[model samples]
Target: MAARPIGLRWKLSAAIALVSALVALALSLLVHNAARASMLDSSRDAQDERLEFALRAYDSGGQLVFDARLDDPTLPEPLRRAVVKGKRATYVEERGDGPPLVWAASQVGDQVMSLNGRFADRDRALRRMDQVLRVGSVLVVLSGTALGILIGGQLSRRLRKAAVAARELAGGATEVRVQEAIGRPARDETDELARAVDALADALRKRLEAERRVTADIAHELRTPVTGLVTAAELLPPGRPTELVRNRAQLLRTLIEDVLEVARLDGAAERADEQEVALGEFVRRRVERLDPEAAVEVTREARVRTDPRRLERILGNLLSNARRHGSPPIEVTVQGAVLRIRDHGPGFPQTLLSDGPSRFRTGTTDRARGHGLGLTIAAGQARVLGARLSFRNAQGGGAEAIVWLPAQAETDDGTPGPGSPGPA
Candidate 1:
């Protein structure tokens, strides 16, 4: 099975949250480092003041007054080495159980003097600041995530609306359009997308209108000539050759009628004249009249309310297509409100199965050829009757066309109600 796709809203929110977290962490680290350095500088200055006072008292009274000593053995080795080599030196000694000690040392003629102090107060303040910073960073991240979700939701809704409009357009709702409020001098990508969709819909509507006019015109123009041709063919001497001409002329006339029906279906002006129908009997009757050789099976008897004429047209077109493009042994099955027609042939082409049939583009093989209007007309008529029609390749290897008739209101006894008017 294919993996489900992630929605754009979640994608955008995750991205924004990640960036916000990184930014917050970086800023928190920077603030912590700067505050730590400032505290350290203040401690250094206090330590220097103590060292100067101790040195001055030793010179005046020949004794140390502060925490000062002559070359203190407890002093760190690195600090002593630095003191002996310079006039003054300072170092910090850290102990695990308590605040770190700050040390200052200087050479005194033949000996070295040193001062030491613990920065317990400063350490406590730094710890408190670290806690505050951690809390602040978390709050920043949370707020940023909330903001991201709000922004993402708004954009997702707008994009979703645009997507719905586009889908309706693809499904032949040419009059549908997307509406978005846009600025005059400044607009975002969503605004641009909405404008493009609306423009495309308008262009499509106009193009379809032009195509419908052309189709109606061509079909109308050919009608008179086609009728006259049929008459002429009938007047020919009765023979095999004359019969062939007459059949061809009648086929031409049928094609012209199919074209006109297609135009009418496209205009969306046809309405279903609903009536109660015994699906099994209807299918058998239509099959017998349309293709006597085709087999019919009433698997589960059902009576539906629908337009009989439109339903028959759908059935006739399917049977005609099966005979023209399929092998022998065509079969029709009626199960409840569903009708299935199958042909033992090569099955439908992949394109037809995937994208539905297109006019004048029959997916025909060497053994089969047609003008490709049969399935299209059938599909259109099915729509006019408010039914669902689909084509697929049967698992055992054959083409199957299925029609799901529209449901009707049930009577008090749980059976389908009597015939009623369809959609207005």
Candidate 2:
């Protein structure tokens, strides 16, 4: 199995969350540094005020006061050396036992007066602020991620709806469309994509309508002349040449009928008259009429509820297709609600197996032998009967076609039950 892809919503949301986290981190760092710088400045200012008072008291009594020191050797060497140079200086010394100490020194004649202040309260406040910033950053990131999920989910839904519409269109559901909600001055790429898809569906629907109309008209027009030709051929003298003409005329008539049928199927006007019937007996009867030479096998009898006429058409087309394009020894098998037809020919061409049969294309080898409408018509009728028809190459070198009846027609034990041989 192929690996599933990551959704657009997650990719967008992650991007938004990462950017939010980075922004939050940057702002937290800036605020933390700025607050730290301001606290340090306040500590220095208070120490300076105390140092001036100490200097004044020393000058009045020739002794220091207010816990002041004269040339304190315990002070940081950088601060003491700066004070000795006859200039003021400040230093912060962090102590393990207490909050950091803020030192301010000033020169007074031949002596230096210094004051010390501690910022335990300020340090605590800063720690609280840092905690608040951390919590706020987390909240910011969470909110940002939530907002991203909301926006991305909306966009992803729009794109998903458009994708579904496109797939339906490819599957021949031309009426399927993306319903986009538009607002003035707020159009986005998704809205544009929806509009483009709607436009494409319209174009395709119109083209297909024209093509079907042409096909139907041509078939109707040729029907009269083709019928007259068959009548004229019938009146000819009984001879080999006359028999050849009659056969060709009949074939032409059949081709015209097939064309008309194709047109009707394309217009989606065919409806099934469903009924329940024994599947194995039905195949045996159809095989008698279609190709008595083909082998028939019924592993275990099963009954199915489906359109008998449509089923016959599906079976007839498959048998005729095999007789015309396939090798000898065509075989039909009925097992439960499944019917399989195998032809010991060059198995269908690679193209036919892959893309399925297209009208007027009987593969690269069988192109001249027959028109490619047999499988197409069979597939169309099978669809109307709500069955799955598939083609594949058999393991022993032959073309095989399998038709699986819908679940409604199947019983769990593959035996006649309440709905067997009843109205569908």
> What's the distance in Å from true for residue 36, model 2?
1.3
By summed lDDT, the worst window of 10 consecutive residues in model 1 runs over: 415-424
For residue 333, what is the lDDT in candidate 1? 92
Model 2 lDDT-worst window of ten: 415-424
lDDT of each: 0.82, 0.84
RMSD of each: 3.9, 3.9
Q: The CA-based lDDT of model 2 is what?
A: 0.84
Error of 1 at 141 (Å): 1.8
lDDT of 2 at 210: 97
lDDT of 2 by residue, 90-124 (tens): 89987897778899998888877787878689999
lDDT of candidate 1 over 306-337, digit per residue (tens): 89999999999888888877777999998667
Candidate 1 TM-score to native: 0.90
Candidate 1 accuracy as lDDT: 0.82
User: What is the lDDT for 18 in model 1?
Assistant: 88
